[model samples]
Target: MKKSTLTQDNIWMKEPEEHDFPAAQDYLELLLVPDAAKKIVEDLKKAPTIIKKSKDILRASRLPLLPETNIHVKENLKKVQKNKKLSPILLMRGQNDLIIADGYHRLCCSYYLTEDMDVPCRLV
Candidate 1:
């Protein structure tokens, strides 16, 4: 009987594909310990995914002059304004949320270079 923290509760019961590991499968069939059962659920909760937005963004800085290539700036601005309530100002982050990993210039341009617009951002 193999015992692992991941088998605490029947957490494995909820997620079957996770038992690709031979040891976890063995735990399911032969070894059923109370402590290990609880740990499995905690591990599942910690399993990371594309992280969600953890905080609200701030839009206070001034925008910049529009570039010749930004012909669609006006249209984008209208789209942002139309859905102002539903959409949130996009921001990128590093380890801590709100750390702008990219889009510094583009975001600045959107606000200053063109009319106010909602900008999308991706953080790593």
Candidate 2:
């Protein structure tokens, strides 16, 4: 399996942005099952639980990375490099798995930067 390319040594870090929430909501709506998406959106309306977790933790929590999404991940990595501040990734708890509602690419990029790197996320 190909590992993520992100590493903390090289990652261009930035704070979270305001627009990230809406973007995450939209992405989750498109990516998740309707019921799951609805729940997530409703959860987002309330205050999100902010957590700083390692890339390794996120990798273990999320679904496997698909090959088709690699290009988009790379693009996001570049965007992060250019602009350090990115919106926080959105995560949801499922019966047995953690869901990434948005910012998969950003997560991958952060993982590539360093597995142990701490990533801030808004999890519901």
Candidate 3:
């Protein structure tokens, strides 16, 4: 089967400024979801081995995720009223695209809280 690659037009493919992981971690700490670490683990295990979803493939094309994406997330959250319940972590395989570094809680929460399933992400 020919894989459907991410196109440039995808809104999530927009370029982002450098992410400061330390700062992001600090923010995550403040957000402090209960069982944050464990959830990350479970989320990863739950994620599929062959993740063919176009949304996730688009996310991977961006390479390292941008840190300045929080602003976008806030806006997206307000717009979305229904969560899509997607996988939190998607492994980056085949041609060095991108992978879910961490932060499954933030992704899940952003989708649930804002209802926008297409949030910007970063790779580890």
Candidate 4:
């Protein structure tokens, strides 16, 4: 599929920055073995970007909506408010709930902006 540096909304979605994978690996390592985490990151790199609803992602992941007071959430909100491009979120399917290996803050920020927002993401 063709990948663009933009999404179909005012809240932009671009390809993940270089450091995004490492961050995903670091966070995944906390919940998995080093090799497994490494593998997932690699898979995510090859994964295609697709769109899903912000509320659906939150529901599948079962993560609570972080308050706007959260520092990271605030930062993400600031970026969006300024029309800065946001990286598409990276996701991994766990045995049960989905794992938001990275982009939790951005996801939360989008949720606050619009629960029905179409979140561009790479789900593995």
Clashes of each: 11, 10, 1, 0
List model 1 lDDT by residue over 57-112, tens digit each: 32322223455356454444444344321121222232343433223333433444
lDDT of 3 at 117: 37
Question: What residue pairs are clashing in model 4?
Answer: none
Q: List lDDT for all candidates, in order.
A: 0.31, 0.61, 0.37, 0.86
For model 3, residues 1-124, the per-residue Cα lDDT tens digits are 0113222223232322224233334444454454653354344444433313334544555543323346654543333323222223333233555434444333433433323334543332
TM-score of model 4 vs. true structure? 0.91
The alpha-carbon deviation from the true structure for residue 32 of candidate 4, after best TM-score superposition, in angstroms, is 0.8
Q: Point out where model 2 deviates above 4 Å.
A: 1-36, 65-69
Summarize candidate 4's per-residue lDDT along 21-93 as a digit string, tens digits.
Answer: 9999999999999999999999999998899998999999999999999999999888876777678899999
Best by lDDT: 4
For model 1, what is the error of residue 2's alpha carbon versus the real structure, in angstroms, after optimal superposition? 68
RMSD of 2: 5.4
Question: Candidate 1 vs candidate 4: which has greater TM-score?
Answer: 4
- Residue pairs clashing in model 2 are 5-112, 6-112, 6-113, 6-114, 7-112, 7-113, 7-114, 8-113, 8-114, 14-84
Q: Report the lDDT tens digits of candidate 2 across residue range 25-81.
A: 677777677676767766764655464655554655766653434897777656666
